[model samples]
Target: MRIGIRPARVVALLVLVIVIPLSVTSVAGRFMGDRVYLLNSTPCRVVVMEQHDGHEANPGETVLIKSGFVDRTPTMMVFSGSAFWFGGLHFTTDTLQVRDQADIAIPPSWLSSSIMGKELTYELTADGQLLVKGPTMQPSMPQPKGLPLKARATPDSKQCRRG
Candidate 1:
């Protein structure tokens, strides 16, 4: 007695095996959101640039982020004037989440350098790795003397209401 296998059956079975897993993975990625959360623990204020996607791609703008003290949203991106540091990297389908947690401490040096008004990009991996496209060169500006804004007392109360 001899046994033989059919070529059509073998081809069909191979297709099923290959196609099923790929279909499942693509669907899962869409629903998973692929979210990454950035929690800030430092006391100093940080700035970040964020890409605003709408019908068309728009130039990202700088966002002023405040320090999170056990309460507040964590900054997803830190803008060093020219360069920006993002919390994570992923495809456009992925979601980026920024939250405030008192436990996560970012290195002071990471936020102190400027990119010389040139655009630079950096990302923090999900596994806690930092990657930079280029070396950070410029130093942060010196703090101003005295208060940032000096307020003077109004001589007359009516002057305060003037536009």
Candidate 2:
């Protein structure tokens, strides 16, 4: 015995098989493509150092300061982030004069002049905890006489772990 289907039925089945899977695959691809992920979870290093007197920081400026580790490499610091959401580490010093231009400007500086060239290093973890080594002070190159301070965060700093 032999069975045969009409040409019209065969064409309908072919269309259904091709069109349905294509539509489903396209939808799934779009859903997955919308998301972004950073593979390596290593923490980013951060440092907050003393700013020159009369320096004004704007809304979005990133600064590099020395690291507390023995290597004393330069690290990035921002006014706002996991560690310094309200304000990061604070220090005070007599040799160096620093100012806080934020809403609350303290006459005495939180970061000391001693840390002028030194880098106060911290590790920003994925969980929002800032891990900092003991504050280390180093002599830093002299900053130009006049420069306005600014608050800025790096690309990695801006991303928080997805819940």
- Score every model by TM-score: 0.23, 0.20
Candidate number of the best TM-score: 1
Worst 10 residues of 2 by lDDT: 32-41
Cα displacement (angstroms), candidate 1, residue 44, comes to: 31
Candidate 2 lDDT over 1-163, as tens digits, reads 1344577778889889998887776555323321111111234433343343211222232232322321322222333335442233232111112235332222222232332232222233334333332223534432222212222333254443333
Error (Å) of candidate 2 at residue 7 is: 97
Q: Which 10 residues in a row give candidate 1 its minimum summed lDDT?
A: 146-155
Candidate 1 regions with alpha-carbon error over 4 angstroms: 1-5, 36-163
